[model samples]
Target: MKKKRIYISEAHKGGRELFYIQEVFKDNWIATEGPNIVGFESDLENYLQEEVHVGALNSGTAALHLGLILLGVKSGDEVICQTMTFSASANPIVYLGATPIFIDSEVETLNMCPVALEKAIVHRILLGKKPKAIIAVHLYGMPFRVDEIRAISCKYEIPILEDSAEALGSSYKGKKCGTLGEIGILSFNGNKIITTSGGGVIVTKTLEQKSKAIFLATQARDEAPHYQHSQIGYNYRMSNICAGIGRGQMEVLDNHVILRREMHDFYVNLFENIDGVLVFNEPSADFFSNFWLTAILVDETKNGGITREILRAALEAENIESRPLWKPMHLQPVFEGYPYYGAKVAETLFENGLCLPSGSNLSDEDRERISKTIQVVFKKEIKNS
Candidate 1:
């Protein structure tokens, strides 16, 4: 019999999730507006602890789109984005007819490079089009250099849209990731720390911003008894059923973070002495990563020329799933024409990085199987050498 496949990430569902979903169905409030939706938004707002208001949206992408709208981004404007992130982070820029200027990642956090960001801002200003906003991401649950990036954003007077989709439980110097930016986005997709099944939320500092987001998300209806029309809007509100799942997920979020961090430690111990394999970790004390997905960089020069692809293939042969890091947006055919600034760090990471199985539900037996498979690969390399 073939071994079970070990996925890089998986959602953990429990009784609470099922109970909430059943309650939503029992209440006959499966659509956008319902008690669970309102309650979940309140829970998130309180968790963030910055007097921020939240608008539950249909997806992280929708939240990004609305965030752009809230920031007054318009056609022909330019928005700077981190190159090494999921496309959703940059796609919203295009949704507003604005161009995205890609900034490469720094090695420490594998996130936006502050120096590159400043350079991009200056270059854009020289071209007679200052960027309308900056979208900085906390990749793989690791907080970016928040202080440095905030300084740069402040220096240039550009608003920041924090892409904390992969970093809900992450913190920097005790401050939550999503609360630091002018506007922030969170994802509750199935593979994230918390699963809403499929949902997102927008976090903003003011009630006015939250109200505007809620109005726009609900199709921008004008005030009147009958059907009315006004500004363009989107049907991006989260369903009541999904919000129930989010509420349940929130109950166990801290446990999820602990499990993820444990998984990271396991990988670290597994590969620490391996000469060419370096696990990506928190760069310093200030960074408190949730370690969403344990990733590693394979330096072929020190590993007898064994590449990331070779290791990935080995894992695949054993029915285990692994994946390469996100390809920098600047290299994507759709984004090839956009302006990019920074060194080749992001490109290098794309070529050599790999995400290992890090599911919170992984069992001891599963870990043993994964460890043995990895050991076999290294042994084969050593024998071949």
Candidate 2:
């Protein structure tokens, strides 16, 4: 018989998702606007606890796009972005006809390097172009160096659009990840910590910003009696049905965070005696990561030629899923030729990193199988070395 497959990350629905969906059905509120949409936003506001307003959208990419628009990013402008993250963080810059200047990662958090960031800022200014915005990511749910990055942002008078798509429950210095910058974004994709099936939100400091985001997201309809258009708009608003799922997921979000952290601890123990296998973790007590996907760095030179690719292939052979870390956006074919800062930190991470299975819904049996696959692979490699 084939071994059961393990997922890298998959949606774990709370029991109450159906209840809210049923409520939507009873109220005949299955469209884009409904009580569930409002309730879900309120739940997020209360949980974020930063006195910020959130605008729900159809996808995280939409949130980032709207954030750039709200930040006054326009054609012929340049935006600074962390190259070590998923492309969604940088794609919106091009959507607005702006250029994305990529920066490298720091080893500690695999996030935007503060030193490199400031250097990039100074260099860009030297070239007669002050970037319009900064995009920083909390990669793999690990909180970045918030104070250092924010200090650079403020010093240069640049607004930060925090990409917290992988860090809903992560925090830095007691502040939630999504509330740390001028604008923040969250994802509710099926593979994230929570699921709205497919949805996202933009976090803003004031109600005015939130209101404007909503206005732009909802086709930018002016208060005219007949249909009218002044500015270009998009149908990016979240549907009530998806918001229903979000409401139910919020009920269990804390539990999900705890479960994911437990998975991280499991990996810590599992790899305790495995030489040259270092689990990605927060560098200091000030950072709290949700561990959205537990990742490890495989140092082949120290581990007898065993590599991330070797382990990834081993996992795949057993019908289990694993993935390499996000390739640096600067290296992608679509983004090649963009100006990149820092040396090779981002490149090194991509060369050696691998994401492990970390679904909150994984069972003990699933973990046992995964562990056996990894153990067997390590044993063979160690013996040969």
Candidate 3:
């Protein structure tokens, strides 16, 4: 008999999702504005606990676009972004007709390298286009080098657009990831720690910025009985129904984080004796990751020619799902020809990294299957030796 397929990351619904969703139906508050939306935002604010205001949007990409606007990234401007992130991190720069200068990742955090970032800022300044903002991401729930990156941001006087889309539960040095930057964003997409179905939020330092983001997100309507517009806008507000799901998910967010971290531990223990496989982990005591997805780097030389792809195939044969790490934006065809700083660090990570199954709802049977599949692959290496 064929085994069930295991996904890399999947949404796990808590018991209360239906309760909040039903409240929306009962009240006929089916539109974008409703009690659930307000309650959901409040829950996030309290959980984040930094006095930051949040404006819910249709997607994390929308949040990024609004974040750039709030940071004053206008046409013909230049913005610096981490290359080792999802395209959403860079797409907003293009949305505003600004250019993105890609920076490479460091080996330690697999995030923006401060050295490369400083170099990019200086070089861009020399070219007569000072960057308006910096986009730094907490990749796969691992907080970036927050102190180093923030210092660079201060020295260059460029505000950071923190992409905490994958880091809702991650923290650095006692502060939440989203609260570290001048402006931040969180994703509640279906695959994230908490799902708003398909929603995100832009975290601002003040209520005024949050109000402005909501105004822009809701088509920038002027205050009048008749429809009037002072500037351009977008239809980006999250629906009340989706926020209902978020409200329920928020009820169990911490538990989900715990489960995901336990999965990371599972992989760490699984690979402890397996040669050539290094699980991606927090570098030091200062960082706390959600372990949204547990990833590993495969060293083919030490594994007797077993590469990431080969191991991925081994899992696939057993009806499991796995994926490669993000190919750095600098290497993507659409993003090629853009100004890129730093060396082949991002490239090397892309070549060797693989994301494993890390859903919070995985059962003991599922883990046994995954463990058995991986063990079979390494056992071959031992036999070859």
Candidate 4:
């Protein structure tokens, strides 16, 4: 029999999604508005344990677009973004006809570098275009240098749009990640720590901000008996059906975080003795990562020329899925010629890093397969050494 393919990350149901989904169907609340939507938002607010509001949306991208709008990012405005993140983080700046000023990452967390961030701010202001907002991300569930970045934001008087899409269960210094910035967003895509089939939320510090987000999301309708629109709006609200799934997923979210951290430990142990392979992990006790996807940095010189690509190919040969780190946006064609700060940290990380299989539903057999495949790849170096 052929071995089943292993994915980098996949949705793991908590067994209660169907129950909530059934409740939605029973009540005929199939559209974007319903009790499930409200319940999911409340569940998220409670989970964060912070005084904040959440507005559920169809996608994290929509949350980002609305977030930029709320931040007052307008045409010709420049937004400072960490280049080493998903394009969704920067695309919103473009959506509102703004330019993106890309910043590099620090080696420790592979997140936005404060030194570079400040440098970008100072230099952009020198060019008569002070950035409107700072878009920082908690890459791969590891919290960014929040305090450091926050200080820069305060010093420069720029707001931070925290992208915690991959960090639902992660925290920094006991404070939740999504609540760290002035405004934040979360993703519940099929591959995230939890799944709402497809959903996200814009997290704000005030009910007024959340209300505005909801209003714009639902087509900016005015309070009238008839369809009346005074401003631009988007069809971005989360469906009741999807929120039902989210309500159930919330029940198992903490357990899933534990499982994902366990997967990170699995990789740490698997690569502990392997030269040239360094597992990505939290830098200190102040950080708690969900380990959304366990990644590694491969040093070819130490591994006798075995690159990350070679390891990725080996995993593919065994029907296991793996992928390279996100290519920094500054290097992509769509973002070329844009203002970029810092040196080659983001570029270097992209060249050397690879994300491994890290799904919460991986069985013991699956682990064995992944472990065996990885070890086999390194054993070739041992033989040649």
Q: Candidates' lDDT values, in order?
A: 0.91, 0.93, 0.93, 0.93
Cα deviation of 62, candidate 2, in Å: 0.4
The backbone clash count of each candidate, in order, is: 0, 0, 0, 0
Off by over 4 Å in 1: 380-385
Displacement of residue 168 (Cα, Å) in model 1 is 0.8
Mark the 10 consecutive residues where model 1 has the least summed lDDT: 376-385
For candidate 4, lDDT tens digit of each residue in 1-385?
8778899999998758999999998999999999999999999999999999999999999999999999999999999999999999999999899999999999999999999999989999998999999999999999999999999999989999999999999999999989999899999999999989898999999999999999999999999999999999999999999999999999999999999888888888888778898998899999999999998999999977889999999999999999999999999999999989999999999999999999999888988888888778888322110
Q: Which pairs clash (backbone N, Cα, C closer than 3 Å) in model 4? A: none
Give me the overall lDDT of model 3: 0.93
Residue 339 in candidate 4 has what lDDT?
A: 88
Q: How would you encode candidate 2's per-residue C-alpha lDDT over 1-385 as one tens digit per residue?
A: 9877789999997758999999999999989999999999999999998889998999999999999999999999999999999999999999989999999999989999999999999999999999999999999999889999999999999999999999999999889999999999999999999999999999999999999899999999998999887999999999999999999999999999999999998888888878889999999999999999998999998878899999999999999999999999999999999999999999999999999999999998888888888889888322110
Model 3 misplacement above 4 A: 380-385
TM-score of each: 0.97, 0.98, 0.98, 0.98
Q: For candidate 4, what is the TM-score? A: 0.98
Across 212-319, the per-residue lDDT of candidate 3 in tens digits comes to 999999999999999999999999999999999999999999999999999999988888877799999999999999999998999999978899999999999999
